[model samples]
Target: MKKTNLSFIKPLAFAIATVGLMAGCGSDDSNSSSSAATSTVVDSEDNQLAFDATAYTTVNISLDGVTMAVRQYRIVYVANPIEMASQSAFGSTMLLDDPYIYQTMIVSVAEASVSDENTALYFKVNNAGWFTSAVATDITEGAEFVSTSDTDAVGAALKAGYVFIDVGTRSRGARAVDGSWAGKAPAPVVDAKAAIRYLRLNDALMPGSAERIVVTGTSGGGGLTAAVSASGNSADYLPFLAAVGAAGVTGEDDSLASTINDDVFAAVAYCPINNLGNADAGYEWQYNGIRSDDNTGSLNGVAYSAGVQPAASAAIAALFPDYLNSLNLTLDDSSALTDATMNSAIVEQLKEELERQLAAGTDVPDYGEDFSVTLRGTTYAIANDWLTLSGSGTSATVADIDFEKFLKFVTTPIALKTVVAFDAVGVTGNPNISGETNLFGSDSYEYANFTQWSWNNNEVLGDGSGTDDTGLAWSDYLASTSELATQLKLINPIAYLNTDADSAPYWYVRHGMIDRDTAYAMQLTLYYAIKNDKSVRDVSFKMPYLTPHSGNYDVQEAFSWIKTKLDAGI
Candidate 1:
């Protein structure tokens, strides 16, 4: 087990201080020194663009008049008032539903009461691992905050005076309105970038500063947020963005006065389920200690749970160190941590989560917990043939044993996915598997999701690897690999953390330690990369103990962080 040699990551000491949390968290903003010295918060003016944030009481954009409603808009940097805003036109699912017809983004400016011209645009999207197919064609009408109350994050942002823009992006589950498989991997990512471009291009007409646009999302959307942050100003989405009428698309040669850029100021992702390529290995390593067995923690009364095809799990876990070693990582102290030790950081994160949840009064069932009960019907386990009773009551203490066994007692087995996981080794397409594979699926929405597995295994036709072009194998593999590499880089934030790709310097990442959906290592790799990158001054990432694959524990804390960044103009 080699160590992850990154000199920028925070040490356990930092974690200790963070776990203890600062008093008046909303007011105490000194926890993360990195954010205080964030690099992007410069005093230099960026005049390359030809727009400025102003106010608009009417709709400012329309897709052949596709939008059915208008969220909010403003006018600035323009001598004439522009009005054509409609919300229903921004299409998702399939970009090519019409030759020039595509999705529209519900642009929001500050509320009618807000007069701050320095306010910034905030994009909020949470489609999760699955794609969201809305209920109405005129989705713009839905962006308005009518009778319904805003959620935690949304409400917090509104109170902070942010102009929230809810984007309508296609996801893996998106099917063409014409019943075709058009919305695929690149579609959602492409649309996401396009939405940002729309905000930036029409900056003069929006209420807030487009240059300071902030983005937030959860799960897969969180992954998208990270990717967009990393892929800022990347040329990869230009062709698609142009086709979607995002940047200065007026008619033929005619166009609107816009920047045509998709850059953002900051990003926040919650349990971003990304880095799919190495997820299996991360999963195996995470659950390596626990054995597979019925509830009592006994294998034929031997006081030990069996492993999950131990050999297979080990084979996958063994690959993790190599991947970790390949990353050019560093720690905050400028010291190198081997991949093995870096992995231990993840384990500690898990332990911290368990303790956190327990303290929160959450019913955390773990071996470390003192109280236990004689759970009936093989529910509780007796470790080392011992169960400690807690004085008089029916409650008992969980039999102390190996930590792995205790984790297993709490989480059961990690059988949610297949042994090979997302790539589907022998399977022809994403339809072969139920989840992530499908998210990567394309072409027919039923197949075409195999990227990494095919690149390694599929013998490209006459290449003499014992595979042939019986079903377009060679052609399919080539196209699949191209899409795979491109989309993987486009969506996986981990893929560009060290690259020159323009990205959001300020980031707030949250991953639930108890989330076994994918390996926590995938998330930590980003943390390690950011901490190691001296160029970035602001980043706050954490795992809520025992939390599921979700977040929003302290929206006010995030708001506080964002407030500081906003004040600093980062």
Candidate 2:
């Protein structure tokens, strides 16, 4: 991203105050108490939110009739905690008289000695669609809602015996009761870090070991999971985090409550919606290969069928190889990955895992070479259209074909897929649609083309007929070469991998094979990135059969994996 010239603008006095807070939060600074009292950031009304000394407390609560001790507190994660805090359980309605709500954090923690291994923390968010984080009770209980289901992925973690912590971080659509951008980019992630610090700061009295916390989330929450896992305690986020009054500065040895580390021991991201900038190209590779004529067919190939205009699909397909090679991925054993090799390795290894699980009666389906298989009235195949099975019931052999031929054979496929880059459709149709478009858009702007494809189509390409396509006004800020460029780097786990900052020592990534909201390649790249890192070894991942854009298909399996990692103490 281009750096702006700040010479023209006048500095706010609040800026100086921020610096003083930073100084107080410095590694060697031990006067946090006085600094916190003297140096505070004020909001629009000149109101300063201070820390409440007794807000952190534990109580006994019963869920499902199981009585357990739960430690719950609301932290003013940022300096200008928003107004919503006033209405919360721990916040005071009196502004300036007590800490404000904008930057406040409500964290809930419970011990699971019988089910938990060591000190593990699973981060929970309500971002099933990566659009909203509204409180609900099930994955699909309400429209575009999640973290509501007690029987989903979250249940597995609870059953696995790990201390759980839920951070009340804000999201894109999160509006303060005062109608401010309280929760925005870097806000949720920043708040999450603060909550982690709070846990570590009180680890001695807390139920679990702070050293072994494991972060977990689904969809957009999973996206944040990747970001948080990769960018743990990075200096880049210090400005935003410190601004929010988060506890635990690196250098400061402060009041027992103030300074602590903010990284986790491991992370589990289920169907993480990430790698946005390049996700479209990967989606194009998967969808464009199917001939448009194949639409509405039984697709003797796979459970779901897909197709778009042949020329359009091919045009999109042409963009894939170059985009893929740019990843520069490699194997743990020092083997460089070419596009063909990586894709081949994905297919081959998946075939083996599928076959192994099937033979073990794990309900995972089986497949053969050529990326094609036949099971229970469905003849599933990918890669090249030349060898498609002619008769449905008889044995068949799919011969070698080109890459463009292999694609999802869906009955009724939508244009650009449900998970295209930046959401090409949701904007004009559903105003509140939860898509990647919402994820990338800032609080001030509800929509922006964060990808070159979106940029070219809506601004430059103009409907592909060589005419002006006024999808949205083009702005330099929204361009990938501008602020979005830097923000993308910040949010993308890939950018933070192999960095000096803390990376989760343990990882469990479970992606659904048929999930098109984003390509399998995004998750594949993440898995390989971590797998290739010498510092990480206990990472395990799987692409489940018949699963869609959701996760946690096999709880027992996930528990077993968690137990293995816990037993190994990685």
Candidate 3:
């Protein structure tokens, strides 16, 4: 049934079985003497990616003042080493400056516990906004020791007997040839899959069990983590993996093999900017007919007036209700999750954050210092008129409150983006294409629209040119056989949640309450989709109060959650 504290049972049973078997072997057989276990180093056959298990360095890292020894291995997971070594992820959308970073992986494990076969694997994908690779040069170049104290949260994971794997994946701007963008749509996801295959193939030499792999990331990387979870062991990525010469893809007769799998046991995503195809509609659905007069915020270092289109916003908002109903999701009580139920769910989550904030005295915009909220130079004091409280100091709770006023007050005057948040329409030659636009682009086209509504109403919303700036027409891109259409499905995790993609059993999701980067509704939708999936065993989702668009803020808590899952025998 439900697993409880079974993580330790297997090791104990193995020990007892070994002891019994050794005792039963009489002294008559000299060869039956007990011997210590030794790890083996095996080289791969020709035409396959080889992992030199003996080639590694060890370092002493401080995990929040607790020192721990770790063995690190830097391996290139792809077969195209020459091309990968020459390419670099040079773009502003994510981290930059590293050759061979996009095709490499840095694996770390506790030196003392290298022989423990029960140790779990933790794969970390950095939250680099998807346009460039998030290179872990610190771990690779022994720079992890320079700022060990600050980044040792990962060391804590190692202290908990978990092997850490920092995966470097290619993003939008990376190119192998002169003009071809090699790091497009399926490249990042495919690279991650190849790394998984490498680990499985070399499991005999690895410190941790390859079966207990857990993947985690933040923001765009979080979205990729979710994608990895949903597309596990699916045939959609076979060709991509074969192209990279991943383990288990090269077969006897030169045909692809399906012997190894990339499915993870668990996943953790923090403040993920996902489901981008529906981002525009979800944004308007949450914030229709709401715009602030103050233009204090600047976009891309350029000042733009804060405004909203009433009719266009209304049309966009109207599309969300049908989309929600179409998913056929169900709630805890086995009730269908419709538009009305979804709104209630969001409100309930909001109320929970409010109660937690009030109890801790950390409610924004005053936070804890002044206990006041300032809006457009107008300051308001907290009182019992709109909110009723009980108890005090961690025990205090919101007894009653005005939901409408609370929603508006918390999210007011911060019109950070335009009505069409993801797909911003402008001139074809515009250099300031949004991240979503670049994500859907290819080698021939560097920017494109993912949604039909945004493409059709570009004039009314954007520069009023009425010309399609995507270089590809909306209808043609939406065709069933179009490459872009398949790319969109492959990138979106929500598309494969309830399908037969071998979804991860355990999920840990966290979104900041005040994050304005993506729509709160979109994050909530991700939560419900995972929760409703019959294949998923458990899910822990939360929106920390007063948090903005950030990730890895609650590292200790996240590790604790992961530790609990491992303890529960995931």
Candidate 4:
């Protein structure tokens, strides 16, 4: 065994202080300095441990075209990992543990840079081994990169001078939230764009020749990577260009298409989600069999509605009294409500009441606790009654309105009008609209429905005027080949290092494997979809049969593979 000198004394002291601070001032204090000091110490320790800190360089690139500013951290490298031990363990029949290690880095960005040219790379790892909190902390501290090395892939990347980026947005919390992913896209897309921007601006962030750039993720992150790649007009999506444009900041053009096709080379994605429109297709639903199950004209008797329910709305109204007392919004003057409608007047009154209470800035009720009552009531009613109420009638008007709301809530595309207009252009080629054919087909009720949904929503958002239905159709068009092909192309580049029959590139895919996740199936689909695409075949896909979803062996194997890739220049 290779014994490396380990130090527990300094970290132990910091840990003691952390505990003391947590006990003394509570963990949420914004001004806590001890944690910052400890972090600095850890950074120094990491620098001492690794002599070649200059192996990686950090850069900040802005995203253009949106109302927000975006940044990214890019880690560029060349090489592939060598295979290590592979065996069947954990839930996966294909478990692998690659011992090869690497360095880690991070690139953070803002939300505005999401687009085809400026893309971010979000990385997710398993719960153990490299995924360990200590390891993740070490990587972040050492590289000044935002990362969580809780899995084999991440650890391996870190050791190989690869920077790891956490995909979840800051708003969604650094860690995964427990509720349904109610937001449109996962947090990873934002982070991925940020990473790409970072890399484009700073080329000194990787070891060896910092030439080609690739983006990859696993599981959920993989899904996001696929989405980013698919959403692009160029070979690589430059999300930062849009961000920069939106920020009123002028600089060199760092469009993804320019960087990817011209500068940054290649992309990699693992277990990607190709069909967002059909995300629910094969998903298990007890009441509906599978979401893909066709039940034309059959009602599930579930009522759905938009916005808050009447009862919850009433409860929120009731809370006004208590809120008013807390906010001191009581009627000091009714002059502001003279020209407002009844409902509008009431709302204005409440707003004024709240403003008054806050203005004193003396004694205030707990906003969280005070708001919880209204929120709880509204949520309860909406959850229990909205579905039934919204879907109650069969009239075309009712159906149309309900569907419209559903579309608005589900797919809030950025440039709704442009997407719609783009789709309308496609309709000239296929004019038929009937329910009998597949919805995604050229002339089907599905197309018409989507078109109407898109148009109405576009009108609502007031951004552009185009056919919303067309965007959905376009997504379907790409789903057949482009999406899957892009994903396969990315993951294919990394060579499998572990020789164990159950290792990656093989284990996660080969039929009948117990540990195979949806990603494996997706890979297979993409493989068959574009087996003939020249741009795709150049990529490689390595598989092993003995890797489990948990444990140190798996982590070791993944790390080894990443190291191999970094070394081999694949």
Candidate 5:
């Protein structure tokens, strides 16, 4: 998808206008000492590498008679010089290099204010691998990515003395690629903190010009914000280097917590996927509806399962090669099984051997009778069971339970097992134990809590068993669906706000009660959760009726709310 190019006034013009508004609003009380206190920029090469100097342009947006020379920093992909220049010529031939291999831009707003004065700093990070230039590309054919509503919201924020910062970090569209998240936390998090640090180090770009700041994002960007805020530790260079596979910086230790001018005062998230490790129960029903559109269960009535399965399998298979290489196993030796197909077979054989070893009270020898005995008991046993029940057919059936079990066993134990092993060997860190730990625990089964309006309430959404009886059974199963929950959670702003509340920065959350994307129901759930949480005092939620996800009503309402917040310094 291609994003529409939005041409707004030049940065210099916006900045001059902003300054004029500030000047007219009140006297510039920027004391020399106050300026000096916040003016120091750390002279570190890594910091420099993370900063995009060229992306900085002056904007002069008029606000309430003040024309401020706002420094507008944009995070854009700095495509490889060779590849960029040859785009038209080399199109498909260009290396599919990672989109995150570029610097980030952070805009800081500086203004003078009294002790009781309220100044707001706005930080906006794009979701996933999206770049500023690729905003239009992120939208679907009928969907708007950054709608006019979004632009108006930003404009209103500025007029209210809110210094808006855009962290043109990596875009979210890149997640569509295969193996993007294999063996790593998404790359956008690193970019997020870098953007935050840049803003802290340079406060001259803000309007209210106070150290207080708020963070906000939607979808994958919301997840990134939540992760950073929830983690609650300062950003350390070593961890950042480890995450991005960059060379470690020596003798430089900066914590992200301290680098923030102050704690993130508040956070606002829009449909954030808080936990990717587990599927969401509420989303499964919606997904099942999508899947049931055709006789054969599939996304968009297409055979997407095949594409999805292989990519996942391939990612799991990658772990074997990585582990073998780490163990110094040669390709020609026993490790030659590292080939995905061969590796899968070897994994099956190993499982059999291990089971035999466990049964025999001794370690099973290589490729021998004991191994075969176990293999026959396991693999053949399943194949035989399928044969006994129903003769082989094209459709999967209950008689194929043994076959399904065997496949799942091999996939999870071998393929998934290797991923866990690699993570242990590579990252060498304990699992994070903090807020909402184990929300998606292994024992947490999912069930769909269907609303009264679901289409599938009377008919099965897909080819799955069970009549479309709108009872607890169906509702439970649908609520337990993970795929829909994954997508919905990705867009839930309330989830982001909850994650951000841990940080000190305040964020304003606005949701349309009737939005289908970020379901009105889900928004209410999150709102109550935040309102009830004792830890989150700075966050606020606003619900407007007669609005969808990206409608004019939502935009205008959000703009008004942002204006009120910035003006009140709440």
Candidate 6:
């Protein structure tokens, strides 16, 4: 609920306007801002970097019978472009999975001047299962065109002069022919930061201000979005940036090139499946005793085994309380998060979500009827009698929510993931081989244990038969226990909160209430951490009722939130 700094916006906007006017009037022809646009710099010994102000295609974007012309620029942001270029060699024969892995696209409304307060930058990094690279396509290929009677979020932003930048980055399975990992921990985030720096160094040629970039994504991409937002300008990324030969890797403080050192203005995350180090424990803590089965793969509603899984799950669940206590997170009133108040906080959040759904006139089955809601043509159902609504449509509030009953109704009948969800020790019969396992791997194909609990107790945690280690030994895991811990800290957003890193000032996080991908504890932890940070200007956290693990469900509303911030010049 932190308010935007209206007092700080006016002068900043005036200054930007004045700068733009001066640039347009040829008042500062010799200024570094003007010179940087046309100048070239050596990114490495072999490649030189420059931004062509005139190199772009004008595309007519039509949404809701309204069309707007925007210029789109597709540029390779890496220093050694040929290394990751199209059909480039990875491992002898394995070609580059995504041709545009090192590229970026900037779309902005056609304008006379480059600098404008109304034109903010939206940077999007794509990730699915942590292994699938973001598919980079031309906007002219009808990629941005979706049929809708009302304007969409991207369309609205474009019309309002917001520059949208889609960044293509390396993901979990990318590797070099030199037998080294190309896309591993720190690579994706490093690529994203490099893209930001590329835009900043070429800010004079771009239509939006580099200082007002907003990064957004969903699921694994959402996790990366949060990482990009949290670790901005931190010294931890210096080596990685230098390795990629990113633009403006070094510069004086507050200089044009120093904008690389600046942080994003805001961030938007939906169902961010991050914080992998604590994810397993958090997942088990919520759904440990809920399911009566031992099936690790599909949610068949058949109680498989009553032996080892329940014990291992309980063991993992027991670790969550201490982890929660260790974070020292605070509630809205600044009270510490502990075992004593966790359930109450969760119940309150659920009630809030239900209240908002009621006010929106969302349809729900009768209180005595089974709980069933369809999303994206898939009807998710559960036996129910726990929720009760008061008042009529648009005025209804959550009369009561049977916490235990609701928990059973949502998670039961369907298990989102296995006991050890994120850091699945793959050796056992349990197919814990998730994308996160590849994410923490040393290379593209190798999966490693990223959590201490899973690593130490892998023998018993896997198979759920209270048996011996039947597959690959835990000691032979790729990353050592300490190394995995370090990587986890590097990717976790909570680690950067209240730290010296220039974390994004504005944040909008949405986790669907019925999302079973990751535990609600993960988002709740991030929400509380951001809410407690004094440096953050504003943070809006919400869980839409009965929504799935998706992003931009309320596209119009999300864009409106971004528009309000842009109008405020923040």
lDDT of 6 by residue, 415-521 (tens): 55755577765422354345376566445334556665566555544332112432433445433234455567778888888888888888999998878888877
- Consecutive 10-residue window with the lowest summed lDDT within model 3: 29-38
Each prediction's whole-model lDDT (CA): 0.51, 0.50, 0.64, 0.25, 0.34, 0.63
All candidates: TM-score: 0.65, 0.67, 0.79, 0.33, 0.43, 0.81
Point out where model 4 deviates above 4 Å: 1-151, 165-191, 205-214, 227-240, 244-270, 279-522, 537-570
Descending-lDDT candidate ranking: 3, 6, 1, 2, 5, 4
TM-score, prediction 4: 0.33
* Ranking 1 against 2 by TM-score, winner: 2
Report the poorest 10 consecutive residues by lDDT, candidate 5.
Answer: 79-88
Deviating ranges (above 4 Å) for candidate 3: 1-47, 64-67, 81-99, 137-152, 250-257, 295-312, 356-395, 401-404, 412-414, 425-431, 457-476
Q: lDDT tens string, model 3, 160-261?
A: 778888888876656543445566676778888878876776665567877788998888888989989878888777666655555555442234455567
Error of 4 at 492 (Å): 17
What is the per-residue lDDT of model 5 for residues 1-570, given as tens digits with 9 covering 90 to 100? 011121210121221122111211111221111222333332232232233333444544444344544554443211110011111111132223423222333343423221223466666665531221122211111222222344454545545556666654432212212222111123345445544544443344323443445566664455555555543322322334323222112232233212232235456665543433221222221122222212222322334344332233233333333322332222223343222333243233334333433354443222212211222134321122211122223221122123233323223211221111111111112121111111211111112211222212223333132234333353464476643333334322233434533444444555432233322222333444455445554555554322223322345545555555555653
Off by over 4 Å in 6: 1-47, 66-68, 81-118, 142-151, 251-259, 294-307, 363-366, 380-383, 391-394, 412-414, 457-482
lDDT per residue for candidate 1 within 360-462, as digits (tens), equals: 5555444334433232223343232212222222232222334454355445422334444555433322123345554554444433434333434433343
lDDT-wise, the better of 3 and 4 is 3
Question: Which residues of candidate 2, in runs, are more than 4 Å off?
Answer: 1-79, 83-118, 134-161, 176-184, 249-259, 291-319, 332-334, 362-406, 409-421, 425-434, 459-482
Q: Which residue pairs in candidate 3 collide?
A: none
Q: How far is each candidate from the true structure, as Cα RMSD in Å?
A: 14.2, 10.1, 10.8, 26.6, 23.0, 9.4
For candidate 5, report its TM-score.
0.43
Clashes of 2: 32
